[model samples]
Target: MSTATVASAPPAPRVQKRGTPLAKKRQWRAAYLFVIPFFVVFITMLIVPLFYSGYLSFFATRLVGGTSFVGFDNYVKTFTDPLFLAGVGRTGLFLLVQVPIMLGLALFFALALDSGRVRGSKVLRLLIFIPYAIPGVVATLMWGYLYGQDFGPIVQVLSALGLGSPNLLSDSNVLGSMMNIVTWEFVGYNMIIMYSALRSIPAELYEAAEIDGASQLRVAWSIKIPAIRPAILLTVIFSIIGSFQLFNEPSLLRNIAPNAISTSYTPNFYAYNLAFVSQNVNYAAAVAFILGIVIMIVSYVVQLSTQRRERLG
Candidate 1:
């Protein structure tokens, strides 16, 4: 024991040597250098502006030096505004009807294209997706012209077929017409998303299903749909968000059918009109914030409900 103690084990090989302060400082500097740009941009563009908006939302601005803190008056006014409520209701209606139809068409097209037996699949896919590449303003303009009652080819065709041409740009039919435009522009985008999901599914699953006597339809329903459920949910959420944000199409089309789409056609359009036309920035902020919250809550609920159903099944 005494001989072993005399060896002293060389101070346990300095197992926990601490770094110098200069070395620690250099490590911290490198980390900050890597992270600073992101923080700088986020703070400058997002955080600061958001905080500024929050502050601005508390006051009512006037033409003269008459800005005054109004507290929640703007929000109260927004809630009571019939035009705002109508816009919200119209957007909800569009979300309920158009989103499902558009996404359904997208899923169908994606599935059709992903099936190896389809002829001219590549060309068809390119043709389908080309509409999405057109600018929204341009698409709206073109479709607005086509939907024209006086000189449109559709009207001419209806006249030729001895069927009376209904006014597509009337107040009663404008929402449906806009829905058609949105579907044409975005179905391809959603199709691409679903197609990507379809491509990622392993061939082995389909092969195994085929070996088990599953028909193509059964395989698509059981394997393909379940596999791409997440992408489907994503497209649905995006469609819902977009339906609420409907502006450019109706706004641009207003030139052709002014009475059909007023200043407040959708929630986003309502906010725009409030801010610019009404000169009510505070009310616009309130409406914008409310719309954002509604979208977030709806998306969260949809995701949760879908996930729960999947888990339970």
Candidate 2:
């Protein structure tokens, strides 16, 4: 019987002592060097401004007594101020009316493109997304020209066709016109988001649905929509934030429709006018802080409701 001596495995390769502690320290030091600049900029640009704004919101500047600490007086005034309330209500109305239409159109476009039936869908997607690439200021100006009360193509065409040239920028029509512009700009942006989500869904799931003889509509209803609910929710939250921040369009369009677009057209515009036009910096800070709170509360409520609905489902 040969005593088989198991050869001891060649001495295990040492991990080379994961480098000396100094080397590890130097590695971490280098990593921190890369990370510090971002934190510095973030704190300087965002954190400092936010804290400063909060601080400014607490004080009140008065002609009679100069700047003085006023506690929550500005907040109280913000909640009660009719102009601020009116602007909030207008934006709320816009949120209710426009968000659904825009998201619905985006979903429709996403589904259409995903179905692979539309001719030249790639080009169509690019065309749709092109408006979003345009700067908001530029887009507003372009639309302002198109919605012009005089010499606009729409008015000219309507007159030529004897359909009666309606004033698109009239007080009653301007909000709706703005809605159209926002929808036109953002639908494709939202569509791209949803489309990307749809693309990430497993093809096997689609194949299985097809094997079950599910129609396109049925597949989308049961599979596509449910799978992309997170993306939809993200879009909803973004739309809500954007609706509250509806400043650029109204501010620029005020030039075209002075009577229709007032200084307090939206919360953001109200804050801007308070700061620059009326020279109410303290009050503007308060208004901005309040607006930020409103946005935060609304976004929180939406996320909470969505969470509850998902859990229940």
Candidate 3:
């Protein structure tokens, strides 16, 4: 019987654990796999186009001579081109007027929401944000119709009231009208940025402010505004970029506003017209890069100023 007993199965082979280096290697591989898609798209869509455009900026394409490298000739021409210079100035005006009004309204709304005194704050916030959710093109078209002197609500109201309709589409008033539309579209987005920053502040600071009998205004001025300066700076930078990149509304409204919105109303508009309408892709690439450089410089200046302020503070 003892001799006939079945041999016990050999102990199962021990499973080998992955060593530290192997585990790290596997983790890195997975991380790289996750990142590869974004890198590919970024290079294909943004970086490659940017470099190609940069290369083109150094060359000039002529009707008779074809394309030839001209060093910084394109850059010099871009800086001196009257149309491009006018577009840059127009864009600067847009930034100066629209940015302040938009940011001011946004800050006000954010402060009101953070006050905790407004009724139905969530509903109000949602309503405020609805305009931003709309596509810029749609918003432009809707507002363009509203500004119409023909059958729009504004004209109808004025007619009913026996008052003459103000021409919002007129060259004299069109820039202001554009400002209003931009402000309406972006105020909420900026408000959300500020409100989020306000929300992130430590509750203890609020409590302490309250203990000192600080009013809502004082608390906001001293505690909230100072606390959210970085967020405000971020919004300022974003607004600056958006102001310079003012293409969609003007472009979409061009059909209805040919008299007011010129083909080169903004630097972006100029680049677009040059590339598509005039069939001047090379020079358009140059203008586009020049604007990009300007944006980069402005943004860098803003960030640098903020850094210096932080160091001083």
Q: Whole-model Cα lDDT per candidate? A: 0.89, 0.92, 0.88
Q: Between 2 and 3, whose TM-score is larger?
A: 2
lDDT of 1 at 253: 86
What tens-digit string does per-residue lDDT give for candidate 3 at 41-158?
9999999999998998888777788989888887899999999999899888988888988998999999999999899999999999999999999999999999897888987899
* Per-structure clash totals for the candidates: 0, 0, 0
Query: Which wins on lDDT, candidate 1 or candidate 3?
Result: 1
Which candidate has the highest TM-score of all? 2
If both were scored by TM-score, which would come out higher, candidate 1 or candidate 3?
3
Q: Order the numbered candidates by TM-score, best leading.
A: 2, 3, 1
Q: Estimate each model's TM-score.
A: 0.88, 0.90, 0.89
Return the lDDT, model 2, position 15: 30
How far is 108's C-alpha from truth in model 3 (Å)? 1.1
- Each model's RMSD to truth, in Å? 8.3, 7.6, 8.4
- Candidate 1: what lDDT? 0.89
For 1-313, candidate 2 gives per-residue lDDT tens digits of 1111222223234633655544445556666877999999999999999999889989988768899999998999999999999999999999999999999999999999999999999999999889999999999999999887679988889989999999999998999999999999999999999999999999999899989999999999999999999999999999999999999899999998999989999999999999998888899999999999999999999999999999999
The model with the greater lDDT, 1 or 2, is 2
Residue 65 shift from truth in candidate 2, angstroms: 3.3
